[model samples]
Target chain A: MTISTMRLTGVAAACAIFSINAFAEDSSLTNPAISAVLDGYYQSAERPMSERVEGFGLGHTEVAMSANIDDMFYGKLTAVIEMHDGETELGLEEAFIQTLAMPYGLSMRAGRFLSDIGYLNNQHVHTDAFSDRPAAYRAFLGSHYFDDGVRLSYVAPTDLYWTMGVEAFKGDNMRAADEHNERDYKSTGVYTAFTKIGGDAGINGSWQAGLSYLRNENGRMTAEEHDHVAVLDEHDHEHSHSAQYTGENTYVADFVYKWAPNGNYKYQHLTLSGEFFRVTDFKPLEEEHDEHDAHDDEGKDYQDGWYLSSVYQFSPHWSAGLRYGQVDTQMMHDDHFDPQKLKETEVSLAWHQSHFSTVRLQYTNQQGTNFDGIEDDNVITLQYIMTLGAHGAHQF
Target chain B: MRINSKQFLPKALKTLTLAVTLGFISNAQAEFNIFACEPEYAALAKELAPDARIYSATTAMQDPHQVQARPSLIAKMRQADLAICAGADLEIGWLPMLQMKSANAKVRSTDQGLFFAAEQIDTVDQMKSVDRSMGDVHAKGNPHLHFDPKRLLGVAEALTQKLMQLDPDSTAQYQANLARFSQRWNDAIPRWEQKAKPLNGKKIIAYHSSFKYLFNWLGLEQVADLEPKPGIPPSSSHLASLLTRAKQGDILAIIIASYQSERGADWLGERADLPVIVLPMSVGGNEQSVDLFSLYDSAIDLLLAAK
Candidate 1:
């Protein structure tokens, strides 16, 4: 048997054991075991890849599990084991505990987690509708980027609805506490709630705005600043590259609107949504001396980007969409860098085969602000989807 | 105590409070702003809210699995009193985003605006396998319950109950409408059963497992699926297998949906001299199937004509 098949077989046995254990312990577990087994089969690595199927992607592997310990508290632990040439690779992906049945729509979560930015950020391997995510996500959001943090979410009641959330985390790094004591950093973020108003006014939407702050320390660089007394009459100075990767502040906001007159009209299926994100990292510079003994101080460079997308469905099964997206990686295209901006325009068309399934095709063209020429890319995809078990809310 | 008594001295204030309370109660019965995330619920909404404007972002012609983060749909959901959809991974990609962006407090989880199809309909194609060989698949059995009219009736009932609760003042109207619909539907069941009796026990091949419910309704034997698995399309090898099966008289004709590639079906039909019937799974799927009732009528007529 293949390694993946063996793994699934073992997991199936383990699930059987878990089901047996549940039945042995509490009759109230219900049919969750069946559901678990079904979800597990898709997430497991035993599935093969071929042309006729959604070819299992390359460089993707995950092992994560979450459990509800009691009524109020729940915990999740996941380790993404990377495979390079069939060898064991270590990576800590997601580990956290959350309050499940929190009071009054207020919930608390803490531990390592994948950051939420665009759609498909929090989903696992098996649950994804398509085999891959969109371009904006792969470029802006780090592939498999997760940080240790705590999150607070609250839902306020009103026709003008409200949902507030905040999170604090250790910047982006895989280092543990013992590995780099001086590299400790902190990042904080706050988000305004989503509000709704006016009934059947042909305009109903949800919007969120956020601000963030981050900082880091490097004692080694601070020590390098101390000039030691030189024995020689002339101080022949040695040089070391200062640690440039420190901390930075960021701000982000996203809004979406779903308006249908009377909420049940055949023509009320129009929708519009967009997201904007900006991050500015503080740049500390060094002084350079020329042969003439003149010194020059370096300037700082930061990065930012935003995208706007819209889609309109004429009916329940057919729709056309367009997205004009551009990113000014100010960090990459700053004064120190060559390019000044990077922008892309993409268009998409989708067809819903059934309530449980859909297929989409997208095309994109890109150009650089710094005259780096241009490149055009085309992507065609067909997806088949099915859903069962517990259903969640519709993200408008 | 003296200060509190003085605050309540205005008799006009009491009258205003009573009027406002009565007005609020009346407004509570105005109507419900419901968003059916899937098109299947759109039919039921038509019956439950005949006067209420009904809309679906998706229609009968496309797949529902891969809707992107559409902004226009989100606008409707923000004002929607309730959001209903087929659970399972049907709308996983689009729905999650809709939830995060829908500003409507009522449509969010606590308000129970998220109504699940499997919760209301009798489901089928539930896999008993734990093996990945079964393919990267759905855990919630099969979510395609809408192909069956019985499931449609269940949705109608669920919609009625929900609408009555949301618009209590219109409870009598909604109940009366539901009774009429149910009675007509029940009365038509015998005719449908009689029409389908002639096609019973007929061996047929389907493009995918898309017609399981349809087959069950007609009492037809599902000899094989065009796709090797439930969702996967038929491969060249699988097509060869079908040819082998067809030659042995194990299968009669190949059934397929209009949206799917008919090349495979045509190829098989050409080789076996078996007739290919392009069946419409939903209203407006074909020129002849323009409405909910005609959708099934076209299906029954086509199947009967084939015999």
Candidate 2:
């Protein structure tokens, strides 16, 4: 391997080892966890520069608006035009709405959305605890997990614990880019619960756990999709031609442990949070010519991922934080994935300027067979948040 | 913390995004209950919740700290679709009393009947606590977190969330209005902060704990209060104590609101030989302080002005 490749691999390996070591030690929160998640849609409305903070299939021209109309409602509307170097449009970046107004910590949301999958899945631009989202989110969901559907969510009320209710679209173009895959729409999911006990030091947060099931007519095409059957000759290439995924069912079980103690004045507190997501009991089919056969990987192919991060607030005006992310999955293969064994590590840094704005800079040194055994990327972001009106009521 | 006539109407109220939204809706057919705790929320309700039945007991200049057992407020609370108040204990003294007595099955802390403006608005004086020695202090930080617009974001959010819930029919309308109003409100933040920034760290005295939060916002140093206890007026020894501390402190001014008595403030100011500026604490107390922005505008000018 080239010197540069060797160095990169070395760093990635070290990160993996450090991540494992970190698991052995407890996290320390220094900032408030109950902090504003800013979705800074960067824009230079009047500036002449064509590119300021725009690059890498991201939008420089993004618009975001937030408002607290009264004591009961708070929301933000975001829309962006995305493209490359000088291309007028690659597509739209974000077209989503987050409305938090309902009795019992329940929020009714509709519009293009980001799949609230793993920890970093739906972390908005402004609200991202770290500057950049994890690679798993990008690889799995990409820019758009676009699927139009309504979602109902509720945070169960229990001191030092968590409970969530979610019903969302089971297709792509949901929270990422809005795209349509000709698959029969499906609605399948149940609520999940979370708990984090023993987080009184005002540093360690509570824990989280939930059970959910989902079903979908996931395959986009029917048997008449094509007219060719391939007989495989042991080589894993496209030796045997066939549509691998016909129809499938999916389920997930997730859990998280946190020690967030922020939310005081200036959020000058700390928090340690981590979560795991596991998939299970799903089946798929492959078709060629006129015959049907089970997909290469069927009968309970499970994949899972998790991450642990810590944030600390020195004062309300200023804060600093660090987060580590990991992912392991084998959804497309023929075997189940033991999430605990597969690993990748990411490190991050963040600075909150105020309640509404933050600047996060992060570096990820990942290894261990994830990302095709290569990992080297830097993500930097500045997030801003603004709300006007009475201020959403939280006295309840 | 200053009194003037500019507040007769705040730009915030006159062209409220909520009010204008009312005009935009061709269908003005729904009726709802609006519970206004402070006169300001009442003022907004009058404009935006015009069709809704209005409810509130306090006026613009009354002592929120002293308002008690008003049957009218209770009746209003009982039938309120929304109970909006300057939260953070600003209305605790009276609201809890009213919430208890009205027995409004609908307006519980857990229901739509309860709305905290402070919660909706970003609030200040969050960490302050009352002590036995601090006269007229709200044991829970400065209940006057409403004095700053930055804190107002919380209030607006809470208000928006509640409005959307209670008036689900109006969610879309409320959202649009909220977005526009928030735009305007946010637009005004930098100007307001700049206007108030100069008064940081100024030393002043007050008749009660009324100025704690306002002082905090302006970064002012409070020297003392005219009253010796939470509800008690200044005593002879209290005056004596003031006399002793007056000379050493760089006391620049003394703030007294119109609803409060002038006797205690006058004596204290006379002793300190400083301006006994009578200020308006809420809307309608004075013309300049009638509107929200002007209320703050006059406050800064009054506090920072040369004697």
Candidate 3:
């Protein structure tokens, strides 16, 4: 057998063994709930599969197992299988143990988990309203920020919902600096603080707003660097050169307003949400080598982006939404590279077949300034998402 | 001289206000907080602790299977001295998160402050083996046990004991309230039974298994369910078969809760010339379903009206 195929088999076997062990251990007294979600899409873009921003592809199939370990703790593990660079890959998406009974309204969580930065960052892709991530999220947060970390959150004792949280990560996020493979990155990685407040606006309306700040001491390009190189290849040919970055800070503010006409969501309802982000002081580290001459005089990089989306549930089973997103980046001083702006507008129609299944059709128009100058891309995606077993309901 | 009198009047008003505020503060201190996962439990808590602050996470118009986690729910759960829920997985979707977020020691599952009504009674429709094809079936059995009046009384009795355990000072008040509630409930059950005598052995269709306890109590036979499975939407083919069966048999009505979709029931009702009845599955489902007693009254009244 091929080496890749053998590796896939090994990973699959390991996942099976782990899941069986968990079930056997928990099911004796209290059975751990098992759930799986399958997502697929038929997508077409104006450009070729390799050159286009979108293409027909198989999305990830996720398997999740979760249960309470004891009275004071709960454990969850989710694994995903998907194609990565023409090779089948299996990865652990989340594995965490959270405290159920903590003092002073405080809860602690440890393990690899998604960051609670913006409204949609904590939600899975399959549960999102659109087929693709928003342009702001893609450019600012690298689509979604998942990290190995520890978090502590405190819900305040107030009439309105108020929560404050802090997270420390291993600095392995692709958007963060992790240049030295031999270095102990967790000690000097990413740290985040966030606060959220929400309350009912009136009889039928409810709203929530949150602000988050994240600091990455040293940011290094990992796999996403390859995509940047690919974009650069469209203009000038630059041979394999590695760049190190330092002092990256990001700020995000998000808000959501929902009106369900007297708290009844079965019929007509409207949800409007928006998020804005800004990143600053991400500069390439200066090295002693002459090969780094190209970026020696360049100033720090700055980026800002925002997205707004609204969904209207016209009926019990049917809903439609529209989103507008834009990202602007101020690049280093260079002749071939200039400050670029990208914008995307998307419209989607979805049908909730049941609580466990959904079918969606989305159309997106992307207009942006890339390495090759101005470009426009139109994409259409028809997607289906189905869930089996038990999946927890999403937070508002 | 008039200005001096006006200033004196202002001081008098301030003193009165402070006295009233203190009185309210003492009254609130004496009261306990109760957070119920569903409206039926909130209504039951009213009978046992009429003066306790009550909060219901979900209303009758909302689906009990799932709910959005709101800030108010967390705040209520955090302050609750007693947390009562119809917990055969009825509030499984949001309750765990709410409990964790609340971080209130009293309401933890292991604590006596946490009470599950389903644990106090026997449940039906429990699956020996569970699968997705069964469509969101609860492995712990149907959690809609409030429809059975007897089970509700049993749950109330247990809840009263829990309240007494938590607040010994209120023991006498809780017992008195329980006695009054038990008398009224016992008296009302027979009247409801007499009114529902014609519904015995009546064949009916339901949108979901939500009415299982109700059917068991009324001796109504659920001939077929509109949904293909527990949570799955009814397919056209299944609706077609139901239509044929409705025409062939003596079907009373197509019954559905206020929160459920009526498309399948309406389609079957239109073709078969049978009435589609929207019943108040719990309290506050409609105007007439103002409380637990009226919830049953409204449901039975709807059924009898359909006939």
Candidate 4:
């Protein structure tokens, strides 16, 4: 057998062994459901050689264990093994316990988990239709937002589906966490609230819309010292610079629509979804100048982004999708520091071999401004995802 | 402390009025709500509790093995007074998550309000040892027990008892409904058997093991399966082999459920010069299959027509 096939066979055997052991050890008790997903990809990007991430890579091998702790509680743990910077790394993706029966129609979850901030933030990468995350998500939320926190949600007793939820987190996200300044870290750093409503539009269509708000109270970042010299008559003077930031607030709105003829998804279906995000109140940086000369570091920082995508399943095995994403960022007050705006367009075609496996080919074209200047890149990726054991169905 | 008869009388009268208003409001909102995982259980629940609001998570056109977690399903499950399902892990993919997310105490697995129709009947084709190679087989045996009329009657009785337990005031009405339904169903059984006599001993091919109960009930022999194993799609080699078998033996027809893909059955039927029959696997699969009795009637009609 080829090397890749042999490796896949080994991985499959290991997964089977793990599942059997888990089941045998807890045969008397309720055996936890064991599932594993393997994702691998071949990607090539047309960019500067130093800035390109092109090659065959293992995306992430995710293993999940879930079961009912008792009649009143349910628990799930997911761990992922991935390749990072040419080294293999293992990390805990999600570990949470959620209430099965709570008073007053309240359900609560606690522990480390992905934040339900936007439409696709909580979903794993393998579940995504595209090979990579949207540029808007990557720029705005650093791919995804996960933190140690607690969430409480209420499902309204109404004819239509209406739910409201709130969460409190440690605020260890891209723009929130400050690893250098430990003493200034707030205990309840980030708080969020969201409301979602969904209903059947007709016999073949359904839609869901949600509004969310997130606030980070205190965040810190260490800005490196930079020195500038004026070269008018060959005279040079050095000035020290450092900065700190406090926090930020964000708002997001998302909507999703799906249609399946006669309520049968096996033949033909269509899904359309979009999410818009706006970030503001990025507290002004406090600049520290070492020289006696006064330096003004006043700047307005703001970011906004949105993504829209549509996936059409024409047959039981074939599907195609297209996505458009754009992000804008303003970090400095200087007019010469052009505000960065990045736009990306991607298209994908996939073949679902069965319920447990999929092979996809995707192409992305990205063009816009970066910190350095105008930038453009083209990326092509071929990915394969396989699931073994009892993987749960995805939520709409 | 001495004697305030006028004030006491007015206060007592006001309290009585408030209590009566609240009681009326609670009574007005007491209508039972049931959430069924499949159309068959929903049809059965409708028979037992005609006044209760019913919601079925999946239609007959959809696969019962897996389902998307729709928001409406969670909402209905949360408000359900009773949750009924064909639960031999038939809904293992989505039901557990729905139940956990709903956080509704009334219909938890351990509660009296939860009813599993499979638990009321004996299952067949149960494997002694289950492995993935068996192709997604249910560990507790086959869960499609609704095809057999006798087993369905037993499930109805059990479900009626549960309805009585949840709503004690409706005990008399539920019992009466059960009696009437049982009598009507028993009378129809012999008539169906007489009509389906021509189908007896006929060898057929099936897309999946979904028709096991129906075959067992009608004494029809399932000679071969288009799919190599349960839940696995038919491969070219498997279909070719079945076609060769068809030439050697007398195969009556190729049968598939409404929810299954018809490509394999059509492919095999064309080459073997046999008819491909699509049967309503559950209620509401077609316009004619509106309820439990009609679901079977429609299925048998399709099967007999193929013959």
Local distance difference test values of all predictions, in order: 0.52, 0.47, 0.75, 0.75
Q: Please give, for residues A20-83, the per-residue lDDT of candidate 3 as tens digits.
A: 5566456453567777787877777632112113465557577888888888888888877665
TM-score of chain B only, all predictions? Answer: 0.82, 0.78, 0.90, 0.90
Over A1-396, each residue of candidate 2 has an lDDT whose tens digit, in order, gives: 101111224345445444533532333521111112223433222111112344333322334334333444334444333333333332223334544345544555565454444333344443445544443333233322334455665443222323344545534321111022354444432222222122122322333344444443432223323223211111132111111222233333444343222212212345455655443332233323323334443233454445666666554345566656555543222222112222434344555432333454444444444333234433344444432111121111
The RMSD (Cα, Å) of candidate 3 is: 6.7
Per-residue lDDT of A1-396 in model 4, one digit per residue for the tens? Answer: 111111224455457557655774565744688788888888885321111246887776788888888887888887766554444445566889988778656889999787877778877777888877776666555466667799999887665888888999876443332323444656677888988888777667878889988887753233323322111111011000001122367889999998887666766788999999887665334432323223332244456789999999887678999999887764433221125677889899999866677899998887877432337777798889888877566577
lDDT of 2 by residue, B16-78 (tens): 977768755733543577777776676545434445666555554556654433334444555
In TM-score terms, candidate 3 sits at 0.84
A1-396, model 1: which lDDT tens digit per residue? Answer: 111112234345445445544553454653232212121112111101111112222233333344455645666655443332333343456677776555444667788766543334445543433333332333334322356777676544334344456666554331111122354432332221222222223323333333322223221111113234111111112100111112244444555555543242222255555556454443323311113222122233444556666666665456666766555542211223222355666565666543334455545455555322334433344333333323323443
A23: Cα error in model 2, Å: 50
Q: Write the per-residue lDDT of candidate 4 for residues B1-307, one digit (tens) a residue.
A: 6769989899999999998898779757868999999999999988889899999988888878757676778888888889999988888878876776567878886356789988888888776667776677887888999999999999999999899999999999999999988998999899889999999999999977888999999999999988787766788899999999998758889999888889999998998899999888899888899988898889888889986
DockQ score, prediction 2? 0.02
Cα error, residue A366 of model 4, in Å, equals 1.4
In model 1, how large is the Cα lDDT of residue A82? 35
Model 1 ranges with Cα > 4 A deviation: A1-60, A66-77, A82-92, A95-111, A118-145, A150-167, A172-281, A285-300, A303-396, B1-31, B64-79, B86-111, B125-129, B136-142, B249-252
- For candidate 3 chain A, the 10 contiguous residues with the lowest summed lDDT are A235-244
Show where candidate 2 strays beyond 4 Å.
A1-61, A65-76, A88-108, A114-123, A143-146, A153-170, A174-209, A219-267, A280-300, A331-343, A368-370, A373-396, B1-112, B115-307
